[model samples]
Target: MADYADITYAVAERIATVTLNRPEARNGYTIRMADELGDAMDRADRDEEVRVVVLTGAGRDFSVGADLSQGGFDFDPESGPDAAWQEPAGRCSKRIFTMHKPVIAALRGAAVGGGITITLSCDYRLAAEDARFGFVFTRRGIYPEGASAWFLPRLVGMGTALDWMISGRLVDAAEALSAGLVHRLYPADTVLEEAYALAREIIATTAPVSVAVTRQLLYRMASAPSPFPVHELDSRLIGGLGKSSDAVEGVVSFLQKRPPEFTMRVDRDLPDYLPWLHDSI
Candidate 1:
C-alpha cells in the first residue's frame, strides 16, 4: 500500500504482485530499489488479505544486476566497522527468506548478479524460455551478496553452485531447469500468468496457516543436523491438529467432495510455539 518509487506493489484476488519497475534500465538493481523491494515484501507478508506473492519485472528483462551507470556502488568508508550495514541485494533476499506467504519469482531475460541472487530466497522460481542467470560475482571481482552461498546450494546442488559461481557463466533456461534453479519455463509473455495460476491454485486449495507453517518448516528444517528435532516439531504440530478449525474443515470438505474454504489466516493463526518464528536463522 505504500508509495514505492522503484517497484510497484498491488494486491488482487489474495495475490500480491510486486514488480521491479525500472524497465528503461532493465530494472537495474539499486540501493533504493532494494529498500523499496524489502518494504513491499514486508507489507505483503503482514497483510492478512494477502495469501501469495508473485515477483516479476515490468519489461522484457527482470534485471541486469547492480546499476553501474553512476560508476558502481557508493560505499562510505567513514562509517567505520561499527556502522549497521547490509548489502543492497541482501535486504530484499533476507526479507523474502522470513516471509510466511509463499513468494513466487517470475523471471524473464537477464537475471544476473544481484538480480538473480535476490530471487534465491523465493519459494518458487518460474522463468521464461529466454531467461538467463549468472552469479557473475567472481567475474566482477566482488563477493556474493544476498546470502546466496547459503541458499543457492540448497536450491541447486553444491557442485552446480560452485560451478556457476566460480565460472560466472550465463545459464540458459533449459540448463537452469535441469539443474533445479527454476521450477518451470514458459514463453516470455506467459511466465507471469503461469506464476499467477500457481498462486491461485495454492489460494484455492491450501489453508493459509498450514501453508505458512509448512513453508517455514521446510526452509528451517531441511538442513537441520538431525531428524530428531524435526520429528519433535512435527509431533507438536500434529498433536495440535485436533483443535484446528482448518484441519477439521479440510477433512469435512474432502469428505463432502467440495472445494475447501479455509478460514485460518496466516497473520493470526501461525502457532506461537513455532521455533523459527522467534529464532533468527
Candidate 2:
C-alpha cells in the first residue's frame, strides 16, 4: 500500500483529508504526485461538501522532499526547457498557498526540503513531538524551491530562515514551535487525533463564507502589502454568493441560533493565480 500513488484525497463529514500516501520512500514527492496534487486541490476547492482540509502522511515520515529515483530535481546551469520541466513540480507545492479552503498540516514524522514548504502553506500547522523538520536544499546543492524562499522568512524571521537554509539543520518539534514554524505539538501517537479535534472545533464555530473569505485575505496579506484591494475582491466574492440559498440561510441561522444549512457552491470564477496577481501587476 505504501508503494501506491504518492497522494490520496478523501472527503467525509465536510472535511477533506489529503494524505501523502507514499511511505516506503519516506513519502518523497514525485512529478506524478505533483500533477495529481494540482488536480486534487481544484477538486477540494470546488466541492461544496468540504469545509476544511488536513494534510498528512501515511507512514513514518511526512515526506523526504523530491523523489530522486524519478530523475532527481537538481539545479542546471541551462535554464530553458529544463526550467519548464522543473516548474510543474514546484507549482504542486504552491497550490497549497492558493487553495481557498482552510488547510491544516498534521505532521507526525520527517518533513524535509519541499515537504517543509507544503507544511508552511497550511493555515494551522500541528506536529508530533517527535517530528523533525529539515531544510536540506543547501545540503543537496540546490536552493529552496516550492515557495520556501519567500514563505520561510515571513513565518520565521530572516535570521532564523538563514540559519535553517544556510546551515541545513533539522529542527525537532519543540524548536519548530519556538521558531514559530509549528502552532501546536502533541505526542507522536496522538498528533493526528489532535489535528482532527482542532479541525472539528473550527468547523463548529466558523461560518463557511467567513472562513473562505478569511483564508483569501490571509493569502493576499502574506503575498503583498495591506489595504491590498482585498476588500474589492471580497465584496465581489460575496456579491456572487449574495443570492445563494446558503446566504439567506446563513443570515437567518445566525439570528435564530441554528446551524446554517450552507448550500452556496464555490464560485468557479475565483482566479487560479490569485496569490500572484499583485506581483504580476
Candidate 3:
C-alpha cells in the first residue's frame, strides 16, 4: 500500500482497513490527505483479494474538516483552483460508489463538516453511540463540499438537510439514525468490531459480479436520470460480467457449498464523468 503520514492501509482476511492516521489534528483532512485516500481506496478496489474496505480514523474523532494550520494546504477555499475542493474528496467518494466491493464507514466520535459528507458516500455506515455529526458549512461562511450539497438532502430530506445546513447544529447518533444518516449505532468500543463482523457476513455470501452490477445500477439510478442509453450500459455490463470465470465460480461454489474465488480485476480506467466537478453543475 502507498504510505502517507495522513493515512495507513492494510489488507487482512479479505478486508482492507484504511485508517486516517493524523490523530493530533483530530484526523482533519487536507487536499493531499484526501488524494492519498483516493489512491489507497482505488488500490483496494482493484485488488481481487479485497472483498471489503473499512474506513476509520484514529484518536477521538473521525475527522474535523480541513487542516488550515497544516502548511502546503493545496486546496484554496477563496481562490478557485483547477478543480473544486470536492474533486479530491469526491474521488474517494466515487470510488466507494463504483467499486465492485463493499465499503463501510466505521464512524466513531465526531464526524463534523466534511467528515459527515464522507460517511454519506460509503455503501454502509455505522456509528458509535457517542458519535456526533454536523453540517457546519453555513456557519463557516461557505457552502458544503464533498458532494454533501447533493447527497445529504437525498439521504435525509430537503427539510432536514436545510435545517442542518442552516442551523449548523451538531447531531447526536440517535438523531442521525432517525434522520437516516446512519444504518446502526453501537457502543463506542464496538463500532469497528461490528463493522468488520458485518463485512464478514457479506463476504460469506453473494457473488462478486452480482454485487458489482447492483452497485453500478444503484449509483446510476440515484445520481443520474434513467434513459435508454443508461439502461443499455447497465445491460452490457451485467451481461459481460455475468459470463466471466469468476461469475461461474460463484455459482459453482454455491452448488458445492464452498467459498468462491473472485478473479475479476478493474482493468478499465474510470471515466471522466467521475471525480465530478461539484460547483460546475
How do these models rank on TM-score, best leading? 1, 3, 2
- CA lDDT of every candidate: 0.92, 0.77, 0.78
Per-residue lDDT over 18-51 for candidate 3, one digit per residue giving the tens place of the 0 to 100 score: 9988898899877777888888888987787888
lDDT of 2: 0.77
| TM-score-best of 1 and 3 | 1
Local lDDT at 15 for model 1: 99
Better of 2 and 3 by lDDT: 3
Looking at model 2, the pairs that clash are none
Candidate 3 C-alpha error for residue 129, in Å: 0.6
Cα miss at 33, model 3 (Å)? 1.2
Alpha-carbon shift of residue 174 in model 3 (angstroms): 0.5
lDDT of 1 by residue, 93-182 (tens): 989999999999999999999999999999999999989999999999999988999999999999999999999999999999999999
Cα error, candidate 2, residue 211 (Å): 1.7
The Cα RMSD of model 1 versus the native structure comes to: 1.5
Q: Output the TM-score of candidate 2.
A: 0.82
Index of the highest-TM-score prediction: 1
lDDT of 2 by residue, 1-281 (tens): 22227688887877888888888888888877777777777788778778788888898888888887877544453653553355544676578777767888899889998777766778889999999998887888987887787778888899999999999999989899999999999988888888888888777766665567567677665554556477666666676665566667878899999876664444643344455444531
